[model samples]
Target: MLQVEDLHKSFDDFKAVDGVHLSVEKGQLVAVIGPNGAGKTTLFNLICGQLQPESGKILFNDDEIGRLPPFEICRKGIARSFQIANIFQRLSVFRNVQVSVLSQQRLSNKLFHPAAQLAVNETNHILESVGLLDKNADVAGSLSHGDKRILEIAIALGNEPELLILDEPTAGMSPDETATTMALIQRLAEKQGLTILFCEHDMEVVFGVAQSIMVMQQGRTIVQGDPQAVRENTEVQQAYLGDE
Candidate 1:
């Protein structure tokens, strides 16, 4: 569903992403694993049009979208979450997701209709999928850190994206929270058949959950294959996983 080829991005004298290649097919759960400077976020930015690539192409469903704006790309059916918790801190959890659903349906600014009632069912459905339905009326900022992360996922789902790009979905979570998050990720791919591409530092999470893994070093892919093949790859161990 998504293809990134020979991608490169540089900042001043340093190359953050260099000649990276990645492919994610429909309904597949793919992961990108690397050390801090591996450029996974940069690649995501390029794909989502947060930053234009210095070279190469990003294709979604056979169309070139490397130069499209972030909103345009999102409209084309790509949605993402950040490494940190991002949500409407002051709004109710339901409202945060409601905003996204409204944006998805382009109903965010209907003056005659009360936004509080807009997209009610859709908003609740997304929150329910992320396991936050009971917390829908709670103040978003009052939720636990783990709950906050899941809230962001709910917000992303408000867009009804065809391909989901999750940046460290399980980051900053306790063990139980991490388990919950991983289960949701798996459910999205298996039960709902959502295509997912993510980057993670947790080896167990990557290997245990991702169907395919891509190891990156210095902004390039060192290995890309099934979990077992990637786990046994010598270069991957040396470059990143060995330290884990």
Candidate 2:
């Protein structure tokens, strides 16, 4: 569903993303893993049109989306959650998703009706999918850190994206929260058939949930394979995983 070829991005003399290539099939949950400075986020930015690639191509569903703006790319069925939660902390959980639903429908300028009423059912469904339905009326800022992350995912789903990109979905959570979030991602891929691509530092989460893994280092893709094969890759161990 997504293809990136010969992608390169540089800042001054330093190359952040150097000749990276990747492909993700429909309904597959893939994980990108690497140490710091691996350029994982930079690759995501290029794919989502946050940063135009210095060269190479990005194709989503066979159309060249390399130069499209972020919103246009989102409209083309790509949505991403950031490393940090991005939501309206002041708004209720329901209203936070409602805002995205309105924006997706291009109803942001329509002040005639209340935003919460714009797509009530769809908003509720998104909340339910992320296990946040009961807290729909609660203030977003009052939720725990993990709940906040789930809220961000619900907001991303508000766009009804065909492909969801999650940047460090389980970043700062406790083990229980991380496990819950990983299971949620697996359910989304297996039951809902949502295409998911995520970057995670936690090896346990990456190996536990991802059907396939891509390892990057120094701005390049060094290994791409299933969990066992990637785990046994000596070069991957030497470079990042170490001999542990």
Candidate 3:
């Protein structure tokens, strides 16, 4: 569903992402793991149009999207959540998802009437999917950290993306919350058939939920394979992931 070829990004003499190449298949979950300064987030920025790659191509389906602006890329069916929650603090959960629902529709036709009414059905559906239906009326700022993260996921889902990129979905959660979030991701990937690509620091979460894993170091992918294969790989052990 997504392919990145020979991707490179540099800052003056330093390279943030160098010669990175990977792909995410339809309905597949791939986890990207690496040490600090490995450029994992930079790769995501390039894919999402937050940062332009110095070279290489990002292909979504058939078209090249590396040069497209972020919003344009979003319109083409890619949605991402930041490492930190990106929600409106004062807004209700329903309003947050409602905004995304309206944004998706506005992309197709800005003149569509009553964006609120037009997006009502979708808003409720996505809220339920993210387990945020009951909190729809609560202010986003009042939710717990885990619930806020769930709200972020719900906002991403509002786009109905074929590919969903989550950065550290379980970050800052308790053990029980992490377990719950991991189960949620696994079930969502299977039930909705959503292609998921995520960057996670927690090895347990990565191993538990990802079918495939990409090990990155110094802004490059050193290994790519299934969880068990990656776990036992000598290079991975010598690299960052195996150290855990």
TM per prediction? 0.96, 0.95, 0.93
Model 1 global lDDT (CA atoms, 0 to 1): 0.90
| Tens digit per residue, CA lDDT, model 1, 125-172 | 888888899999999999999999889989989999999999999888
lDDT of each: 0.90, 0.90, 0.87
Q: After superposing candidate 1 on the true structure, give the runs of residues whose Cα lies further than 4 Å from its correct spot.
A: 111-115, 241-244
Predictions: Cα RMSD each: 1.4, 1.5, 2.4
Which lDDT value does model 1 have at 46?
94
Instruction: Judge candidate 2 at residue 238 and give its lDDT.
Output: 91
Query: Model 2, residue 235: what's the lDDT?
Result: 85
| Better candidate by TM-score, 1 or 2 | 1
Alpha carbon RMSD to native, model 3: 2.4
Residue 233 of model 3 has an lDDT of: 89
lDDT of 3 by residue, 215-240 (tens): 88888888889998998989878875
User: 15, model 2: CA deviation in Å?
Assistant: 0.9
